[model samples]
Structures are given as C-alpha cells and as structure tokens.
Target: MARIKDVAAQAGVSVATVSRVLNDNPSVTEETRNRVHDAMAALNYRPNAVARSLRTEATRTLGLIIGDILNPFFSELARAVEDEAREAGYTVIMGNADERPDQQDHYVRTLMEQRVDGLLICPTAEVTPLVEEVSLGERPLVFLDRTLSGVEVPSVRADGSTAIAELVAHLRGLGHRRIAFVSGPSTLSTGRERTEAFLRAAAEHGLEVPEEYVRVGDFRAGSGRRITAELLDLAEPPQAIFLGDNLMTLGALDEVRERGLDIPGDVALASFDDVPWFNHINPRITAISQPTAELGRRAVRLILDALHGRPTDSVVLPATLVVRESCGETGPGKEDGS
Candidate 1:
C-alpha cells in the first residue's frame, strides 16, 4: 500500500504539503497542490475519509478504551496501540473508564458518536452487556487484556492461571506454607482467575488457605495497604503474600515499611504484573511479568486483521515470573531468578 510518505516523496514536497493539498485547506500554492495531485494520481494514493471529512461524515480514526490509564500497564498498552495506529495512518482517541461501568458505557457511546473506524476496548467488570452490544455493531472491535463473557471478539491476554501457579510454587519453595492472597475485586475475569488460581495452587502445595487470609480489594495502592494491614493483624499472620496487581503491590510495600517490617524477612511478598518501578524500589519486588509489549502488539494486529477481514482468534500469551528480593528470608535461588 502506498503511504503518505510515498506521496510526499513523489511530489518532492513535505508530508504536511501533501496533507494540506489532500484536505483542500486553501492554504497551499496552486503549483504545490497540482504537484501533490499528480503524485497522488501516479501513486494511486487514496485520500483517507478524515482528510476529506471536513464537510462529510467518516473520520478515519480509531477509539481505544482502557480500564485505567493511570496504571502503567494500561498506559503502555495504549502507547503501543497509538504508535501502531499512527503508523497505519489512523489517529487514536483514548478514553479512560476509571474501572467504572457507567464511565465505560459513556466512553463507548462517545466514541461511536465520533464515528471511529473501529474500537479496541478493555471492558469494565460490570459492563458485559455493553461490550457485547458494541461487538455486534457495524464497527470492528477487539478486546484487550481481559475479555467479556459471550462476546465473540478477538482478545489478547496473559496466561493468568499459569502465572499465578508459578508465583505460588515459587513462594512454596521458599518455605512459605501460610500464604495470604490479596487480590482485586472478583467481578473481573483477571481478578477472579488469579484468585482462583491462588487457591488451586495452595491446594497443590497441600497448604490450607483460611478464608480470613484471602482478602479482595480494589486494584489500587490504598486497597493494598489497607488489606495488607488487615492481614498482618490476623491471629496468625501469613508468612508470605501473593498480591494481585501492581498498584496493590505498592500499597502493601508501603504498609510493610510503615510498620518497620523487613521485606522477605518478616512478610514475604509476590505480585502479578511487573511495572517499571518494581526493580528500582528497595528490596525489589518479585513479580509475574506478562509480555506487555507483545500483548499490545498482538491486540493491534488482531484489530487490523479483523478490519482486513482476516479471521483471528483469542490469544493468551505466556507470563514470566521475575524472582527478586521480595519472596522470603532465604531469598530466591539462582535457578529461579529470571
């Protein structure tokens, strides 16, 4: 396919010149406009609808709906999507759901109003019906990270069960029998799957996980801190904790430090999702590192494939467990570190 750069090169003008001529902005010289038009004809450059939509309807743009743009994970994913979309000559419209169903629904409706060519969505926990409705719409849509039940759309996600099991096994190897599993709300598939995997992993190790030891909170630093404090005050505090998400991990770490308790020495910690700051912090946190970049790239590809009428299926990428100093008193063995 001939790109804008090709048209610009052929016209011996800058990309901006080509854009101006294509939009008929009345700001370009007649000679320059003719050169661009000749180049477009020679290269068979198809003007995007948005460039001509100043007086018409279609907007050659894509909408990206993320659960929480504040989180590094979602931000990175959004960045990747934006980069890919721009390279394909499409602009991206981003909307933050704040993990709220109503906000998500509003964003979807707003994006539709903007006449986006397609959508990439990370659905909120409570908006399954909304997701299904969008998927059934004329615009092509692809789900990212977590998927909605009964929604037959291409999706990209990490292997939550395997990642959780690996994290739990690593904790068990460090001699942590009584482990606390702190998680986000079980309403979402990611949270629910991770929590269930924690329980199943505990059973595999013949460890009894008491109900009090398992606490669910919002996927936030404050929730992590609050829940970690509650776990520590239990009659028999857990020797180790498997935290659900990155924000929750931050909260738990803050709580542990505030209490003057040493990491791995007093209460071991492990979490899902390895964010950028994980390594720089004191007593680096051990984490299950999902292929975030791969997930983002694959999600974009899936959407593009659907747009091109290329059939694709839901994809679950593998996760890597990065063993750091946060596991137990003895620390991770050489073979386990990644």
Candidate 2:
C-alpha cells in the first residue's frame, strides 16, 4: 500500500509538508498543495483517519441529540445540522431522545463513549444530571432548539413571542373568542416560552384561556390528538386551537378530520414550526415559521467556536407568522413579511 513517505518522495517534498497539505493547512503554498495532491493521487496514498485522529486528538466528529426524530421539524433540523457539519469538515452522529430524559442521557453517555469532539443537543423536558456533568467536562457542548436553564451552555433558538402575538391577533381578527392551546411539556424552555407567550398574547387581546382550554402535551402526535379530542369534547368547545409544534399540529389535524369537522369552520387550527407538508395539505396551516436551517448552522458554529477556544454566545432568531386558510386568514396582507 502507498504511504505518506511514498507521496512525499514522489512530490519531492518533506513528509511534514505532505502532512500539512493533507491536513489542509493554509500555510502550504497552492503549488505545494497541488503537487502533494498529484503525488497522493499517483501513489494512491490514502491517509488513515484513525492514525490522524490519534495524532491530533480530534475525531472530527460531532454528536447531535434531538428531542424527537419523529417530528418533521426535528428531522429537518437534523438534516441542516448534518449539512453544516459536513461543510465544516466534520461528521455528525445523531441520537433521538423521543422526548425522554433517560433516553437523552443514554445517548449523551453513549456519544461521549464514542469520543465525539463536541455535542449539540435539543434537551428533553427535565435537565438530566448527565448533562451537567458533561457541561463541566472539557468536550465542547451547545444546545440546539431547546435549552436548559443555568446550564451555562450556548444555544441557538427562535424567539416565538412576536409570532405568538401575531397568531393571537390573527385569530381574534377572525372572530375567534374562546381559543384553546395544546402546549408542549413545560419542562423544556421552548415549551415554556411558547406557552407563556401565547397566554400573554391572549391576555393582551382581552381573551382569557380557562384551565379547561389549556392542555399540556408531550410534543408528540398522540398527545396532540388526545388533547385536541378532549378540548373538542368540552361542553363549550373552543372555536380555535393553537398547537405548540408541528407534530402536535398533525395530531390535531388528524383528530379534527376524524370527527368530520371542517377546519376554519368548526375549529380553526394554527401551530408553531412550519413544515413543508403544511402547505400541501387541504386548508394550508398557519404557523410560526422559524429559521430552521439557520438555527442548525448557528448551533454547529457555536460548538466549533467552543472547540477552538473561541467565545460563543447564544443566538435567538426571530419567527414570523405565516397566514393560511386553516387560520381563516385568506384576505390580503394577512401574512407577515417572514
């Protein structure tokens, strides 16, 4: 098998210069880099990834732990993260927590055992003790989408307050008086922030959401369906329902369809996290459109910065309300300039 020595001899350069070219060190002149590449190709010299990692003490891999892979939003986020990681010359190993703390911790420990250079996580409901331990360790860590309080880890997320308010205003304008909410687990920062923002917005519009109208969900389709069914079965069912995320929105839509109810006529529907499928469905769903790709890219950047001993800061991108037929917003000027 061809080796680095063979490549160096063929290229008429020292092994160190070949190594620099292999490592993509910008210090190597373009001519030297081209010559080294030609030599490597001619000699069929393939660098051993394991040997390189052992020497550099870096695996060039990242661990991404998502809360739920079943959700389209999360799936899209994972794809974006992988794309960004790949662009930065890193590979990503992903773990799905399924919104469970134990599962999240298990993935964290397993990824650590695999010696991933850094970790990007969408935390589950409760802050696991394992997370704290990992944060204190030398390995770089960053939160994506969902964040833990007091963890001191940088994060990239969307600020949904304005979008929530816009949604509330849109619903109110559609003559919706009694509105219900299907909220995600309050233990997560995203769940808590979105839920609180909805309540605040509703209150500002002089609308009060009674206890019966507020249902807590697990950010899953089943919880959304169950909660939506409960809300619909109430003696005074709400005229509209706001879902916390896309998965629950699917659940709500399923339940609404099963009951032979027409959207925007029986119960108007809107949700956070706009997915591509939302547009293709009958009565296109209104949603809070987040910068999903940007969020993923920023999260990876933050982890890279941490790994390189550079300071990292949390990033909060803005979300905008996308008006559609589901929310009874067919009039002109209904959609935000998202």
User: Global lDDT of each model?
Assistant: 0.81, 0.86
- Give the per-residue lDDT digits (tens) of candidate 2, residues 1-338: 77666788999998668766766677999999999999989988776442233123579999999987888888889999999999999999999998888998888877877778998999876765567656655567899898888677788999999999988988998899999998888888888898899999999999989999988998888999999999999999999999999989999999999999999899999999998888888888998899998999999999999889998989999999899899785758774433
Residue pair clashes in candidate 1 = none
State the local distance difference test value for candidate 1: 0.81
Q: Quick one: how many clashes does candidate 2 have?
A: 0
Which structure among the candidates has the greatest TM-score?
Answer: 2
Across 210-265, the per-residue lDDT of candidate 1 in tens digits comes to 99999998888999999999999988999998888998998999999999998889
Worst 10 residues of 1 by lDDT: 329-338
Best by lDDT: 2
Q: Which stretches of candidate 2 lie over 4 Å from their true place?
A: 1-56, 335-338
Model 1 bad stretches (over 4 Å)? 1-58, 128-130, 329-338
TM-score of each: 0.80, 0.81
Clashing pairs in 2: none
